[model samples]
Structure formats: structure tokens, C-alpha cells
Target: MTRTSQVVVIGGGQSGLAAGYHLRRLGLDFVILDAQTTAGGAWQHTWDSLHLFSPAAYSSLPGRLMPPQAGQEYPDAQHVVEYLADYEKRYELPIERPVRVLGVHRDGGLLRVETDSGPWRARAVISATGTWWRPFLPAVPGRGDFGGRQLHTVDYRSPKCFTGRRVIVVGGGNSGAQIAADLAHDPEVTWVTQRPPRYLDDEVDGRALFDAATARRRALDAGRTDTGGVASLGDIVAVPSVREARDRGLLKASPMFTRLVPGGVEWADGTRAVADAVIWCTGFRPALSHLAPLQLRGRRGRIATAGTRAADEPRLHLLGYGDWTGPASATLIGAGRPARDAAREIADVLA
Candidate 1:
């Protein structure tokens, strides 16, 4: 079956929902194609202990503010899932689920979205597929030869299964810190990083980071000297759990290992530790495989964009991948602006 609309959104997550909200406000006909059978997007798959670094108020979608969770400073994964599910319903966004998009290709006057269910033809297509589905694990020598289990952030659910085991947690970003803290009490964890982990100030959180990004963006727009944004600050946020672990001296990080051995990993300096398991919180690449047919990606493996519109293909827009799409566009609070801009641009183009 072939369905047609003014716009077709390739993701039903936060970014897609935001795009839908704005598109509906502009009275544009669109449908959000979501791969997942249910709502909540990636939040439903995050570790059970995962919590936002910001308060619920700071983490919200357009047209609605997330209701505060009772007795929780920062909302947990389930809370976020509920919020996303509710947000989807509250706005009555048009969505089709369990529809895995195979690829997107240009079709003379429109874009054709090929999905497992059917094909959708739209004047414009918004690729809002976020990064959660693509967990990145660095290549290490002897990784396959290791005798223990290995998992990435996407595969991790909790530390309960690793209890009483010697586990090695690798990476230096927020996930690495949070997962290390989560396993600190139950497992003998050796947190290894490329360098010492840099922590944002105790007082800093997502709101501060978003504001910094916004200010920096405004500065650049005004043709002023570039002021540092979130990148100028450190990486890890001092969430309660990370802070508690830090206070207990359990967050100490070791330099990254050179390679994995049969029993564990070894450093270039000849330091080695035996471990039963390794948890890699290495991070993720953008989930853009469905956009492959367009061949818009540059040599750097990213699509060049003028705002949300693809620089090479104006009929296609990318969203929610990272800072390149918009300032803080990946976050719940930050997705709105870029979504609004994309909707308006698509509307203008279709007008």
C-alpha cells in the first residue's frame, strides 16, 4: 500500500513527536513512522537505574511540561518512559508503529519512505531516528579471545547479574560514570577511561548545559567571538549517585587498557587486571542506516545540513541526532526549536 502526506516523520521518539506537534500546529498533514511497537522510544530500553541529570521540569517536550515525579529529584528511566508515552497521547500525534523504515529515496517530486509495512510518499521527510539503537564499542585487540562476557550500554539492564563479579567498565562519558556508580556497590568494578574523567561542577546539570549551548548559539548568530558552551565544561554531571560514589572514593578511574587478554585487559605500561566481564559504555553513532539510499552523507559520515534541512537534499531534514542539527537538539528540552524550524521550512517549501 502506498500512503501519501505532506510530511512523513521517520521516528516517533521525542524529536519526532516534537516535529509532529509543530506540523499539526501549522496544519500540515503528516504521519510519524515509529519502528518500536510501543511508545517511550529509547527510554524504555535504558538501564533500570538510569535517571536524568536534570529535573523533570527541565526535561520536557513542546506543548507539554513533564509532570514532576513524586519524591524524585531527577526522574528515572521508567518515569521518562511514562512521560513520553503520555506526551504522545496528550497531543494526539498521528503515528504508525512497528513500521521499520528500510530506506528513504528521492522520488521526482517527493520522497519515498520504504518501510517493512509499506511505502510512504511525502513532499518532505524528517529523519528523527535518535542514537540509542546504535551503541558504539571500540575495537580492542583480543576482544574476541577474551574469556568473559561483554556488553554495551544498549545491552545492559542492571548490575544485579554482575553481582559479586570482577567487572571492568570502560569509557569516560556520562554513561561510563553512571554505570560505574551503579555497579560500585554490587561488583568489584575497575573503571577505565581514555583519560581521567572530567566532571561538571556539582551545581551544573542539563538546564545549565542547555542554556550555555543556547547562549553560544546566539553569540555565533550575532557574529561575536565564539564563547565556549557545554564543551568548555567537563563531561560527567554530578548526579546524586555519581556524587555519592565519588564521595566514597569508588569513582576512581584508571587509564585505558591497550588490549584485552584471555583473562582480562592489559595496559601499555604492563599493568593488567583480571576480570570476569567488561561493560562498554562507549556511546553511540547516529542511527542513519535508513538514510543510506540517499547517499547524502559526506566523507566524514555525516549529512551536511543548513539548519535541519539537508544541504544536499532539501526535501529531507535530519533531527535529534546531535548538536549539528541544532543546539542541544538531542535532549528533551532542546528538540522543540529545531523541530519548529524544520516544520516551518517544510511548510514553506511545500507551500
Candidate 2:
């Protein structure tokens, strides 16, 4: 039997939950299909030590504020997982778990979502599947031949696994800095980046980035140009551990190696460096392979979007991927307005 819904929300992560919250408010008949066996979604897969860049108050979804633990300014991954589980319960969002969606195809005027749990028909679909599943690894020559461990940030868990081993952490993003700093306490770690990593002022954090992004959005909406002086939230923030690592002279990053060697990596001048493990902190591409059947992808594998709605398919909306869909859509607090707007639009169309 084909299950039917007014809207089918794919992926039950932060963005999906936020969208569900608004969808409920509008009394829309929707179903959220999650690939995970449990409730927490991608937050369940993050490394144990990973902490939110912002405090709990700033890192919340729509409608509900995330209550931070006492004396803990930043919530860790576990806390986030618990909060997501609680959020779903609080809203009573209709979600089906362990129902991995195989693909979404146009069947007549409706969209047919083929999943492990059978076919689901919906008037509209929201692709909220975030980028965690699609970890990016640069093509460093001879990487395949490197005998030692090579892992992306997704596979990393604790620094204890690399204790006493010489490890190379690649990438200039916040994840690279945090992981490098975390590993430096015990392991012999080297940080590498294509360009020098930019560190924001100690006072700058996710809140500052959100404020800047809001201003830029306002300016763009008013047909004015935004100055480039505002720093990207992706830039490394001086968290306590990162600052302490800098004090110990362990936060310095080396230039990216030209290629990987059997036992290590080499720079352009053929200077070789030995390492036991290589951690690719490189970012991720959007997890949009399932959407490939729709042929909506454009340059750099990004779907052209008009206010969170797919440019090619108005019935399909994308949420929580990044800034392209909406301002700060990838963040906890940032996703609220976009999700709310997307839900309202979907409700109107499906009505």
C-alpha cells in the first residue's frame, strides 16, 4: 500500500525537526522519515568531544530554547542528542525511523518517495538531510597507498586512539582546529592547511557571525552591497582548549603537503614528513545524491534555491543545508525562520 501525506520531510535532524514544528503549527499533514534507528539523528554520530560553537541559549531550534547544563557554557554532542530526543517528544512530531529513503521520483503530479519501508506519496517533499553523511576528502596523490590510518572527521571519536602517535590533521576550518587542539594534549600532532587558518577575535563567536550574516542579508534584500569585513562563522573561534593549545605553541598549522607518501606526506620541494595517522578535517558536500534523480544540481553540486524552495521544482524545498538556502540555515537558531517560512509555503501549496 502506498502511504500518503501532504508533505514528506526527509531526514529527522535539526532542520527536519524545526520544519516539523512549524508544519504542526499550520496543521499540515506531514511525515518525517529518518534513516537513523534512534531519535537524535546526526548528533548521535558526532565525535564524543565535539561541542557547540555557541552556548545553549544561542544554539536552539525554533519555539524552544535549549537549556544549558549548569556551569557548562557550551553543550557537548551528548547533550545535543538528548535535547533533540526531548524536542521531538515535546512537539509530538510524526516521524518514522529506520526508514531510509532510497529516492524521490515524480509520479504524475505527486512525488513518490521510495524507501526501505515501502513507497510514500506526498504532495511536497522537504530535503533536510544535512551534510554529515557526505564527508569530503581532497584528492592527495598516493593517498590510497598510505599504509597508516587515514580518517575523516566523521570517523574520529576520541584523541586517546592516537595517543603517542604522530598524526597530521588537515584543513583550516573550525573542526580542524578543535580536533588538532584536542589531540595535541597527548599525541604528536601537526596541523596542515592550504592557506593560513584565520582565527577570529577572542570575543567573536557564533552569535557575532549570526549578527553579521543577518546584516548582510538585510543589505542584500534592500538591493545594497554588503562589505566583506565580517568574518565567516567557519573561521576558527578561540575556545578555551584552542586558546590553551595556542599558549603551548601547538596550534600552529603547516602548509598542506603536495601529496601523500607510503609512510608519510611530502611538500612541493620533496620534503617528507612522517605521520602515523592522517585526519582529514576537510568539510563536506551536501548529502543530495538522492535528489540527483531530479537533476537539480548546478555548479559545485549545489541546488539552485529561491528562498529554500527548489528553483527547478517548487514542490520540493531544501532546509538546513547552508547559507545558500537561507541565512544561517545550517545553525540551530538560524534554521528557525527559514524552516517556518518553508513550512508556511509548503502548507499554502498543499492546501
Candidate with best TM-score: 1
User: lDDT (CA) for every model shown?
Assistant: 0.92, 0.88
Give, for candidate 2, the lowest lDDT window spanning 10 residues.
226-235
- Residue 107 in candidate 1, Cα distance off native in Å: 1.0
TM-score of each: 0.98, 0.97
After superposition, which runs of candidate 2 have C-alpha atoms over 4 Å from their true positions? 229-234
Q: Can you tell me which runs of candidate 1 are displaced by over 4 Å? A: none
Residue-wise lDDT of candidate 2 within 1-351, one digit each (tens)? 899999999999999999999999999999999999998878899877788878999999988999997777888888989999999999999999989999989989999999988999999999999999999998889899898999999999988788789899998888899999888776478899989988888877778877777777777778898644245444788877787898898789899999998899999998988999999999998999888778889999999988899999998999988778777788887888889989999888876
Task: Give residue 253's lDDT in candidate 1 (0 to 100).
Answer: 94
Query: Which 10-residue window of candidate 1 scores lowest in summed lDDT?
Result: 180-189
